[model samples]
Target: MAHEAHSHEHGGGEMNWKLIVVSAVFLVIGLFLDNVETFRFINPYLVLLIYIVAFMPVGLPVMREAWEQIEHERDFFSEFMLMSVAAIGAFFLGEYPEAVAVMLLYCVGEGLQDRAVDRARDSIKRLIAFRPDFARLADGREERPEAVTIGSIIEVRPGERVPLDGRLLDAPAAFNTAALTGESVPRMIETGHEVMAGMIATDSIVRLEVVREASESAISRILKMVEEAAERKSSTEAFIHRFAHVYTPVVIALAVLVVVVPWLASLFSAADYAFSMWLQRALVFLVISCPCALVISVPLGYFGGIGVASRKGILFKGSNGLDAVTMLDTVVFDKTGTLTTGAFRVEQTVGLSPEDLAFVAAVEAKSSHPIARAVVEFMQGKPLATVDSACIVNVPGYGMTCGEWAIGTLRLMKKQGIVYDEALNEVAETIVAVAHDGRFVGYILLADTPKAGIFTLPQRLKAQGIKLMQVLSGDKQALIDKLIAGFHGHGFVKGYGDLLPEDKVSHLEALKKEGKRVAFVGDGINDAPVLALSDVGFAMGNMGADMAVETADVIIQTDEPAKVVEAIAIGRRTRRIVLQNIVFAIGVKVLVMVLGVLGVATLWEAVFADSGVALLAVMNSIRPLHRPRFEEK
Candidate 1:
């Protein structure tokens, strides 16, 4: 997965502290001269002069934008339009202090929003920073990561980050993968194991042969996914954006009527109508009508949630995936490499002598299947004799053939007309039958252990109101039943076995037909179709295939089942915060606007309605940024 350089473009630039300081000085001077009789020697116009200067720096940018909205973009309903109109109207009405205060408060609010959004951007920026700038070569030469070529060896010393994705060339070493996976525990990697960039060498210095360029490394991909996630807005965010655009123009029209209709009506009647007062009231209405709160807060809430999830090693490709997780009623998980460790170990061997086991190991060594690798690993350190053999042939969905013998499934032996005296019954474990010259030699039993987190996942999800907890696998029904039996107290509802890849997709389709929003979790190439077909797809990042990464909506970098629970919790919290902001912003703005229309609310209250609510909503949006505690790995 090659990634382009991450874009660091934020909502806006850093706060203009110099501008703030100068404006504050002018405001203080204006206030002192206007209020203090001791300063009466200064002309009133001089005080107004100070105030105008104060307003220009902080308020000019906003007024300019409002002007551009009308003159160029033809967008007259912007918050800037409302604020600029209100502040200038106040100046015209001889409310000089109020006019200066209005724009000053708006500047403060804008500064706060800039800071809040920058904080959210920092969440992913910190991850991008994990990519080491330089790598120490095998010969003690330090060079830029981007300059390192493939097959070049690099040395990662203790406490130093691995610079690129590569194969370990040194002895087995422990590396801390928290930067990439968010799991604090160090993982031990064998000499030939593939090691991703961004992991720190925790125990000893390790040499690695670079397998990927800096841009194509795992860290690059993770950074790319997380940074781009903000582009995918949730339904709530999109609606608020649309609402703001439409709401602004309508409010402007209403503000116009507030000024014209009442003044016109008063001219035809006996009611005392001061045009200035009515005009001032319309200005207050404009201030209250600004849609800044809803526009700034809603998206911040989602981005905050995404930042939090990234810290937890969960990469939600978009806000849509984060949104979808909250709506999941049922989560479907693949058996291998998901709930259970995909690595198999030879548990037991039946009716096999030392020589026979060695011969089988030799035959299995010629193949690269996981089952074969398990057999080879199990036979390690054993004094086994290697037999000279002809071409090794692989039988799809069955086993492999070596010379005049076959080592594979019992069905393969049956297909080859090999008979065994042992009564073979389908069980929860994997069994590979070995034959010699069309005669049963022996069978080796292999088993994959369930991940530690899978034990408690079912019960936790059940407690969270997930109604049906099930496992779908292509393994035999007897094995699936046995695995399901162990999960009795864990709240597993059903187990579907003897399923092909398409069968899994069909089951998900059926669930969708039943109105169940399903999230499928898997890490293999075969899981790609079902992963894409599901409502939300969770791919185990550590061992996941390229296809899975490309298709799955969410990538769990740590490969922790507990993260599934964490993701759901994150989504729920994020959605809650988003709703809270929407309701609070809208609720506060509506109340203040009604009060402003009735002439009960002042310019001060209007400022609060526009900026205060925005500040509060932004503060509430960042609640998800707090680090969470997960079960021990």
Candidate 2:
């Protein structure tokens, strides 16, 4: 036992929980042996020595910490000192079993906390592993992604991730975009499509013409966001840290008063007094009020929340953003490129055969116009008939013309002397009027379409306690009405259109004046001002754009507005669990401290109040890492 104490003293033992288990087992055996006439020692001191030996392994680490605090930092009132005083006082009081139990429980609790922290940080470590470190050049030279120059070509082989943000050279391929978009379905791409750095080429070796340097890649920028995420603490986290600084010292001072005031009062009274009794009460008070849970558990919960969010492809700038999300009463959305896919898509096809549509798609495939691109995208699976590249002439103002089949606006139909019905002129939608030789084939109506996954988003946010949902757009009021009507107009959204960027800012300011905590969600590229102006700005659907990352409080790596619902759900759960830890931990500690001072609670209860509350708080802090209510994944 003497040798064990010497080793623990010099070895600088930390909170070694396995040693705690061993000591606990030794303590149980010592107590059992004390009851047996044959096994028990005759000398009471030798019997007490067994308990003392059991206490040494668990007690020395905390004693070492208290001594180091006194020696190096000159601070004697830390939590370690409080626990040390309590354990040593219990030994002096001849509460040998409790003296062993307190340190054992405290070490186990602390060890559990360290394990939770390591578990929470696992997601970040996964993020670091997720990044593709090396790029392969077309010539088979391997280089670090950051060293690769812009416009240089890199090869992404089968089962390898793209190493930089670049355009596909010539081969059409399928890529697993789950790292960027959070969608598991493979994204099929054509020759000129821009592929992001982390996308894994599913089947074949595909090459990319590097458009952005590796440092500027989406994954690199996201990594930067995540690594620095915990620096800005939540208001709750900040308050606890500040509270601990004053709270621990006050606890120690109160503990001293607990012993001294009673002894002073006894000096003036006729009542018999013992120094040991008052000192024991003070020691229990110190043990019960160490503030371990209050100091560490809040940040543990928030850090886990941040790590979990990052793993889901949602990057919160800090835990403060996570806290802010719970308070949002209003979520305002920008219509263009946010709620709706910004580009034109085929909304309707009138009088056009599937063959005519296919023919038209083949011709429009040659043009880079938004409407033409939309047509080709709509016909993704349908076979496109071949177009004659030799005689294909793109008239600047109108549209494309192959030999016999001409697909363009009505003006092109008039120019080609192809007579179309007068009703074609009355069509409100932007249309492609197809002409076969001199006969008019039917036209296709193109419109900007709403995204697929956002129908449940508004109600979900409302259920999250967000009161108002609205859209702000620069499009015409009529167009905005049309879009809102598609969402079942009377449902929840209030539309404001014909607004400039300044108008959007003023609208947000007006909502703020109404005492609303607003979160504005927009394509982070163009809404920099509005993004920065709101209570919590959510930047949507971009991975590689620097402006998107810099402008918003939260970055949704995928382009789904439904992710906003997931973000709110995650944020609320994290903050809720953190508050639970705070209330439960502090409440138990306060109750136990009072009981300890009144002599109603023993060292056993005080130990439970200190470390047991901490263990429960730590367990609660990890709840945020589980899937939120709405999350299936």
Candidate 3:
């Protein structure tokens, strides 16, 4: 059954491709016949027969789509209507080939648009499938399977999906959250730490008392937002809708005037103008005024931009959100998952001699504690041999140890009968004390390291005149300061630590008050509030929290910080194409309308002005698909 559904989707894509090719062929032939009189020697009826044959595939889809919209009672007349009217008018004038050509070109443009929409929606749908259906709970004696329900308080074993939004009730465990944050490193979640659904447990089994029900959980809300956002139209699209309303009526009126005014002028002035010539010019006017280019290409350009973004691992909900990203002048990032690697690492090791340090590292290496991993990684590659110790213990929020070497905070070491050296404890970095057989060995300092491309990110944002780079996070002030010290001193970079989800939203609101066009980038379930409130929200699409991805204006599929730059570039490019299409479509139609009134334009010229302009606009709108510019690491 799944294979059948997949095949159906594949067939849909194939059909669109076939339609585009067929329509392009018809358009080419139609243009050729218009330019070369030799092709006109063929009986017009024979030409008309070929034209109608070419029109079927293109016309069928347009008519189907238009019928769907009409069924839903949509007031806006679709591009299909413009194509249909132009074709019917051509047939009325016995210009059969032109009628078919207009529908064919219009269908090619619609096919491209449909494909782009499908690509963007498919990218987002993949994220929706990540929600787990079952939860495992820790009974007093053994693990038991629990039926998943919204708001059900359940225990999560190590390496299991968090079943609901809840607070941790057990000891700290390492969390493999790459699926939510796009950063593959595991994060440590301690007691009182809030974890959302979709994050996988990596180390020890930690119980979470569910706070939010499954239905009202962060993931559900985000999914709803994404689904709704797709329907929201942007300013340019709304303008196009209004333009079509006024433009369509005016053109219909002009077509009427074209027939009446020319015949009346010929009668009053006693000029030698033929009635057939005037009527032909009127038919040509109808063709030129179809507005297919503006109707088809503007939306197609935005749709193509969204598709291109999806290809690079960004999921834009719709064209409006995609368009808004280009206008943003400032970007605010969540400190933990957005700017930094969100993984704690050992920064320095101190205390015992090099060989003794290796012993402590070897023992600590087996543990999954963030501090333990940091310490072990610090001593990596050094020649160290140590027997496996008997008693391994972990002290949450402090450190861990094996046998006699006690690795923990200074307070923990003091409780273990080890004295903290005044000089050693005064270091600026995070300190974890080490004790050997009740004697002081030294301390290991751990910190959240910046991602590989982080330093360059601020510089790139600066170059784009994105003057604001702020971090809103729930991390401690000391940690936030230490993590961003290198970049935080800049006037444009600000760090706000100890922020709640609501705090981040409030901060973003303040930025808006200051007149900054803000874009919030985050990954956690907690980030959803700010994601929704921001002018534009960017989620680390790949490995980002489901709720955050759903709430975001754009999803960075690769979770690369630099892709934000690429998204902004796409928005700008799409806007440029939209403007060019509008200008070119309207300019040609206006010029041809003037020529028709002067009897200098023929029925063929009007058909080209209508369908050819639409084809040119559609082709131009898709040009950005070939010019994607991603940020370099």
Candidate 4:
């Protein structure tokens, strides 16, 4: 059967394509008429008539957007209002070409701003495309997908997106999570693995009993967050709103005064000079008064910054959060899953020789388990000989093995008539015991190890003026103590173990109270609340839970701890560029407006004042795209 394409009522890509084509047509017509000598002989009035017709395709939409804001009782200060009023006034002064030039240039600027917004929104829309549309049931039935409403259950087969929030009902499966995490790798998931929607199944088909419907799933919530963030205005946008609030009505009042006062003054002064000269000056003021730079480039800057961060695997909840990250002075990290690998590994192995150990290791490696992978990673360089064995078994939270040579939990060894040896057990690190033909052999120990370069990360952060480094985890005190001991006297390295999700939130709140900028780093379903509550959150992408990545402000795509430092540097550099753009734009506009009011500038100067500043601000706003600073540890 041919599958139907997923449809939405939102009219995706249609309006954008129309805007692009219309903008292109207007630009071409304006350029052709301005350069053609044949058109120069045409009355300037007739030429403007043609130019206004050309401008309508782009100008009508701008007018419509302004009308919508007015209808919704939103503030009446918009760039469209400024452009429309200025062009009308210019025409009244018999400057038809100047009127057309003002509207045409303004149209081009609006088109560029719209294109940038569309690009940022398209990035988020691509994220939404990962939603699954079909499910294959366990009863040999394929089900037609329904709308992703709240509380709906859906089934997912191997190589399909998990359609809803669910728990595994059958054996373990492997999942390729590159779509959500930005890590191009697959992870193994066993029974009771909290599976979220939008993850692709890689190996083995396992049944997932849906708990939350597709709409209420994590992916749906994340999509909503991203959309809200894109729409949320930055501080620069707020300033523009306030400026327009006063600037628009004030300009209209000034234009009225210029018309009435000049006629009033005509009785005392030369009448023709007062009428023509003051009216011309009023039109020039109107052209210069338009806040085109603020209206066009401020939102573009915010949108572009957000888009750049998303490309680097950072998910800013809103422009507010994106701006906040750049201002942060200190970044706090949750230790267990953020800085560490978050999985157990064989730190050391003892007792048995290399040959004997390989046989026991092969028996334990037979099962699909996290501990099994840890053992394999530990024995990476050691020679291993395969042993022919049947009756391979797995003990949950314990161990596994083949035949009489059993490698499993301490309790399993005791049950199998094996004697306890404390000295050898301490040396092995993780609890792993072996039994050969119903006799006790030896065991191996494992622990969750720190990620590469984690020990040296604090030094780099301190050099960047990050004053505090704290490790908060739910792991037991013994493990936390081990981690603290590993980093003793390394620039305020401390650990608080056995913290619940709520406890972590409380700790972040306290840090905020102390006027400290805190950034939480975590992975796992339990860390979602803490991630959302912190000033900024960074999640470890590889092996991280879906909730962590979605909640985090920044996601480290690679396993290296050094990326944390690099991300901070990127944040600072982007912020510097934003400030530079704002200062340059506002300063130049003020100086030029002063000169124009004193009769030192003309209508052409006004055009350059409005459009040139806007263009420069836009160019500066996108500087982060080329100069992204990555720190080397």
Candidate 5:
């Protein structure tokens, strides 16, 4: 399902190299008959016949395409029609070599550009490589993922990919999300959490209850998006299409004027203007005015940019997504998944000895509460004291206890008459009070810890010309303040917490009214509406809700905030290269056309210049593909 029924095959078919080779042989013979002394006795019409044969092999396809466009699409000013006209005009002027060379070299250039585009597309289609061929059910029978109905229980052994999006059952297990997220670290998904398809189980065998069907999974949607991205053209592409429609017809009119105006002037004034000379100049004008370079290179540049982003695990929904990235002025972030891990972790310890932590960890290991799990996970790789589960006592609302130890809230301390610091009530984070031998020990402060590399991401976005960075979360105001204080040294980021989904939308609407181009980054599952409201919505994961997959403008598969800056950098690079091609192509064409009118440029000279400029523009358009790996600033 990931590889779909899309075919990249151009309607023109593959490069007609056999046809080109045959045509080249005939053209060479024609040249020998027209100019060689040994063939002076041959009839001139036979020499013309040889050249027409040379032209048909390469020329007929273009002529057929032009006729079809005119008959079917009513598009008379197409590049196909322009090249066909130029070829026939050269034949009318008795310049047989120039006539055949124009179409021949054009086919060559077109073939090269098509190959380059195919390679760029192949880079993005690498996503299909992550797909698994079969799903193993709990009964040891294998089936296609599409046949596995929702709510079915499936078991995936270690080193296997999850075939469908499902909820983890039984126990927590680690999964390697490198294929989806581009991050190499193994991620542990707790019991009851949604495990998306394409994640490889890294350690122990895990069982899952399918929550979504194979056709509705994240990988399927992403593959569909990648296939449609090229069709959803950017603003520049739309503009170029409109420009060509008007520009080509006008250029054709000017080429006619290049002949008729001179002839009319010779009849009125004392000027000696030959009709044949002016007609040849008009042929040069048509050859130079072909819009091949501009038309092909513009899309080539954007495709190259898309290819670069895909390699780094970033997916832009369309080329317009690339354009939107360049205009982002203000960036809004969802705190939990965007800046922090959104999971509780022990931040610090107050006066707690290693022995006390060990005792607390050993006692906490017996519980299924989130806070208890946080303590157990944090104590990993460290020492822990032994405690009997039979002797441990669980207080319904306070905390847990074991032999000679009481761990809970201030209420537990007061109930047991254990005295502790009353000032600790002022702490904003979750506080775990510890007691050893019925005496007050110390406490542990826990909160959602920041992700590994988010500290540097704010500074990098600012350096990339992002005007302001802000955070809006449903987390408590005090906790939000603490998180902001943690980032205070790194950069200036505005924080606003305790906002509901609707409140976030209202705040962004106000920002939009004030003319701020906003981009909001979130986990996408919980904040799909706010993401949809933003100018550019950046969703964090491939495992998010179906609404998230549909609403987001860009998907950061790696779940990294830093990828946004990289997307912007790529947009800027693509825009610069596209502009260069537009100016370069038109500038060269205009200059050559003027020289042709003044009789300073020849037909073959104009032909070579046009082909050379196209080749160079295409070379420049593909520069994004070979760009070095992005450096994290």
Candidate 6:
């Protein structure tokens, strides 16, 4: 299921606004009776009763929670424990107004924290809404997406979303894939082309055969991955949790020392110091030393960062993935699917007759390779002679041969001693040599255009101090080199082509051995091995294979190379904001604790130290959610 049973509902359950209202009313009356001389006729005991009544609404819940922690979990030093103890201690010291106000402010702070988290969760939820709720069946009846079965032909009109992953059964049409790929460009998909869910048909009506169930669709899986991301904590979050475990008990012990040690020193030195005065300071110390700010703000910062990434069409599997992205110094890319569009088109046909084209198409039809598929797609309009595939011979790496005609790469031609013109080898396009029996027939040129803004991606990575950026592909070395040379202005450190799946992993392994934090980016299915082996794996979500999406730690939903840089920027910003909160929370609390114990800081200062700093930290966590300069669009 895309959504799960979350323990805490986003945006704290319906707030006790009535309780807050009652507390505020009693609090105002109590302060007026105590401070204003006009109300001096009212009994002091009655005013104390008003203060106690005001404290009850907010304080009772905190006290019960503290009690539950002690009785059930054998735990102390939680935020509830500190607030409850401090409030009760202040009340006993006859500081009734301070006690009531502390509880009131803490409740307000809790409400604010919950609201901040809710905002971040809602931002992410908006991105996951890409999945269409209904699919138009062939019979023109719209049904729930989950009820749509595989092999069911669905009709989608212009502006309607494709409800499930399917293969187009109708003629080619334009689709707006911004929701899926994060790019606004409309893509033209042909008949038999696979289309993912969450894409909107923008031009003409399109019919497709559902290839996957709703639960197994790409949109469903992406939503599921994002929903579960928060369960996996980062190293910083785990450390803060451990720190709270030890820090809380130690600070509580110190608060006890602040009271007993001062009173004992006063007795021994024969100095005039009231026990109540020392005890009041100790209560203030407990209030100031609460660690709610650090604990709550750190996780909220990571969530905010994840929300920002989702807006840019990037999905981090966890905060750890976001943390890892901040530390990445090296990035590896797969050429065909990662850097280039991976959609091959026929650029030119060389010295080929209609009969020769038919022969080439017949031989390519027997292969499942992407280049072969491109060849078959190009031969759609041309008249082709029908040839039976009863005796087709398959050859890996080289090409295939059907009876008399053989079609493949120049390497295959070289192996078979079929002579071909040397001029064909000089072209940058992927050359497919066609031969009949013992003689060379002709060659067809196929080209996969690089995606827009890909060249700018390397430069941006370099600007961010990414030390190494390279492309690894199984295409010809000359083709890869020519492609890299075209983008001479960008910082492409190296390009290695003619590599198999294992070869890519070997290169990545070598980089890891050099003690560098390596990130491998590719369309998941083809680069699964390398993606799994790297320190961090980034998958092209929009066009990525299922295996890649499942294995990758981060998925670029937009399939845009620039989003990688944006992801890194968000990661770095999140880490900085979290650190700022931790340091600021701890630093302010420590300073306030010292002042409180020294009798310089009062209950008013304690309230700000506990609740005010927490609000500030929560506000700081949403910094990354705003548009960064590069992501203005």
Task: Estimate the Cα RMSD of every predicted model relative to the unseen true structure.
Answer: 4.7, 5.0, 8.3, 7.1, 4.1, 4.7
Please report the TM-score between candidate 2 and the true structure.
0.86
lDDT of 4 by residue, 1-633 (tens): 000010111112466446546545654666567679877775656656665775565456556655655666574655556666667677677665576667656555544544444554565667777777665555656654344343334456677888776787778888876555555667777787677677788776667777776666656765666677766666656776677677767876775676677677776987664565666666667677776566556665666666665555555566666566666666666776677776888765657668767776676566567777787767778877686655676666666757666787887876666777756543324577767788776667788778887888777777655778888888776677788777663558877877888888898889889999887778878888888888788777555777787788766655456666766665565556667776886687667656665667777678767777776776666655555554422
TM-score of each: 0.88, 0.86, 0.70, 0.73, 0.88, 0.86
Candidate 5 whole-model C-alpha lDDT, 0 to 1: 0.82
TM-score of 3: 0.70
Question: Against the unseen true structure, what C-alpha lDDT does each candidate score?
Answer: 0.83, 0.81, 0.69, 0.66, 0.82, 0.83
- Ranked by lDDT, the better of candidates 1 and 6 is 6
- In terms of lDDT, the poorest run of 10 residues in model 1 is 1-10
Model 6 residue pairs with clashes: 181-558, 524-548
lDDT of 6 by residue, 295-326 (tens): 88898899998887876788999999989988
Cα lDDT tens digits, model 1, 1-633, are: 000000111123454656766788899888888888899899888888899999887788778777766786677667777888889999999888778878877777777776887787687888867899899998998999999999999998899889899999878999999998888788998878899999999978889999999988999889888767878888887898889888987888888898888878888998887778778778888887777778877887888888888888899998888788888889888888888888899999998898888888888887778899999999999966666656678899899887887889988988998887546854568889988887898889998878886767777776555677778999888877777887774454578899999999899999999999899999999999999999899999988997898799999998887788888888878888899998887898788878887889988788867888888888898878864652212
Of the candidates numbered 5 and 6, which has the greater lDDT value? 6
- Candidate 3 root-mean-square deviation in Å: 8.3
lDDT of 1 at 612: 84
- Model 1, CA-based lDDT: 0.83
Task: Give the per-residue lDDT digits (tens) of candidate 2, residues 430-463.
Answer: 7788888789878898877788866677667767
Better of 3 and 6 by lDDT: 6
Output the better candidate (2/4) by TM-score: 2
Candidate 3 vs candidate 5: the TM-score winner is 5
